[model samples]
Target: MSEAMRKPETNGAPPVISVRGIDMVFLKKAPGVLDGLARRAGLPRPEPVGVHALDGVDLDVMKGEVVGLVGESGCGKSTLGRVIAGILDPTAGTFRFHGREMSEMSPQERYRAKVAVQMIFQDPFASLNPRKRVIDIIGEAPVVHGIVPKAEISDYVDEIMLKCGIDPAFKQRFPHQFSGGQRQRIGIARALAVKPQFLVCDESVAALDVSIQAQVINLFMDLRRDFDLTYLFISHDLGVVEHIADRVVIMYLGRVVETAPTAELYANPRHPYTQALLANMPRISTEKQAFGQIKGEIPSPLNPPSGCHFHPRCPFAFDRCVAERPRLITKAPGIAAACHLLEEAAR
Candidate 1:
């Protein structure tokens, strides 16, 4: 085992949530009989392929911590978010919340868990019902779960809206009546209505304009202070992730390549893939030399590269990296990376 695969010492703080060895696979739809027959006549085989969305991913999020999950599109970031939110069952592995296994819970317990961990989806407009009033949308969860009476639902909705920077009067309007930023605020209000301890924010601000994104980001921070909320903030935008995340996990080809403090990871990214990603970030001045850009397209999840999944695109890949899969191991305190270059550097 490489030094990078070794576990780092913990500071005695228990993680609020832990995801161990998660694997998700989606089988491709079967091809038609004609296509199968064509394959017999020198055409490509019609065998069903599997998309490995999350391959043995392990993650730990400490209590009250905001962890950013960043990766390119199709890298399985959103899939991981859904799994953590209990919206999608994993093909393998276990998810635990506060030391309790989530999969083993009863139906009532599962409902409680769902209420405890809420989701803020990317498109606020699509997430909210077009015909439903803001109050109905925001208060639905609390009312359904018996957290508040129907008579009190309006009051609870108003309070949450105010906290999320939306006016109480707007609660009477339909989702179509609100602006994009206002709509997102309504989404936040709805998530907050459940009084969730943890939130899965899957590209929550990606659909909004730059100005709106900042507003929503600030609102999330303020709510964290007021409500003590922990977040699994998934985004493709590194700038947004850096602004909010205490720790950041970089994923590539459905696996975590590196995990570290936001500042440390940005300053000294251990994995070559991470370095390539950071290098592509837009710089303010032309005087600054361009960092190394990542070359080549990402490998398809249906047919991912063998050994280290990133070997095909990694600039520093060696012969060993082509044949030996690297495991996420600690390189520094609270920092873990899965890369052959980091292992060599550590040695």
Candidate 2:
């Protein structure tokens, strides 16, 4: 295996989540409005376009490690997270938990895998049901999953609530009753109730204010230590990922472009897309900064460019980049990038 594909140093243990050749393609919905417009114009109905969300993605996240997946809004980071969290099945891929492929697992084993992995969604308020009280929201899963007895559900909810820094006294209150941060805490409590080993945190702190973001980030770190939990921290915020991630993976236009140890990736990005992303990131410097935007708006997923998906936006794109897809080439130990420039440099 290439260094980037190798599982983290875990004393011979297999990766907690290993997905290979993952591809998520969503068919475009033909809205009623579109059909009405077509009829009014006397044109044929439009064919459904396939929105390629993920393209041949491979990733290995080890036990007790934080892997930060950073990309632009529509670059499939969220989709990849959801795939790992078992929310959405990919169009093509092999999902392997530990050493066992998900396809080979029996029903009982599949259920156990589902319980072992959990997802914290981007919108806390939208994720929580308005009709359910806080206690029911957090306690229901555990009771149904047999993690806790129905009679002890309330006390069990209270324990997790305290651990997540949410006040259990407000158990009877609705989701709208708490602040954004508290709602997020409730979401965390719900995920923890199942005693999950891995968490797919999709923009978990993005909605919070700066101060509240810090609190939530710290809470994640504390929880990791306390519970020995592994995390797939998906976010668009480079700064936040730099602070909390051990390794960072950068994706663009439905493809993973670069990955490396957090400090090294930040200090010396190999791919042009990674360089552009880091250059535009807001920095705390007294010196004046010149933020250079990546050229062109991100291409639509409905008709992604041929060859390398990022070729249109990459500053270093050559004729070969326009004609041939680049596989990730190992740049240095623990670092790899998918770029034709690196391949040319090797020759």
Q: How accurate is candidate 2 locally (lDDT)?
A: 0.91
Q: Give the Cα error of residue 107 in candidate 1, in Å.
A: 3.7
Compared with the true structure, all predictions reach lDDT values of 0.87, 0.91
- When superposed on Cα atoms, how far off is each prediction in RMSD? 6.1, 5.3
> Which pairs clash in model 1?
4-329, 5-329
- Residue-level lDDT tens digits of model 1 in 1-347: 23232222236755767999999888787567888788789777746678999999999987778899999978999999999998899989988887778768888887887789989999987999999999889989898889898888888888898999999988889999999999999988888898998999999999999898999998988888789888999999999998888899999988999999998999998888788888897756758767657778988888888899888877788898999989898987789999877677778
Report the backbone clash tally of model 2: 0
TM-scores of all candidate predictions against the true structure = 0.89, 0.92
lDDT of 2 by residue, 1-347 (tens): 23442234687799999999999989776457878888899999866678889999999998978999999978999999999999999999899999799879999999999999999988988999999999999999998999899999988998999999998899999999999999999999999999999999999999999999999999998898788899999999999999889899999878999999999999999999899989999989999888777878888887889888888888778899889999999888769999988889899
TM-score of 1: 0.89
Off by over 4 Å in 1: 1-13, 30-48, 286-292
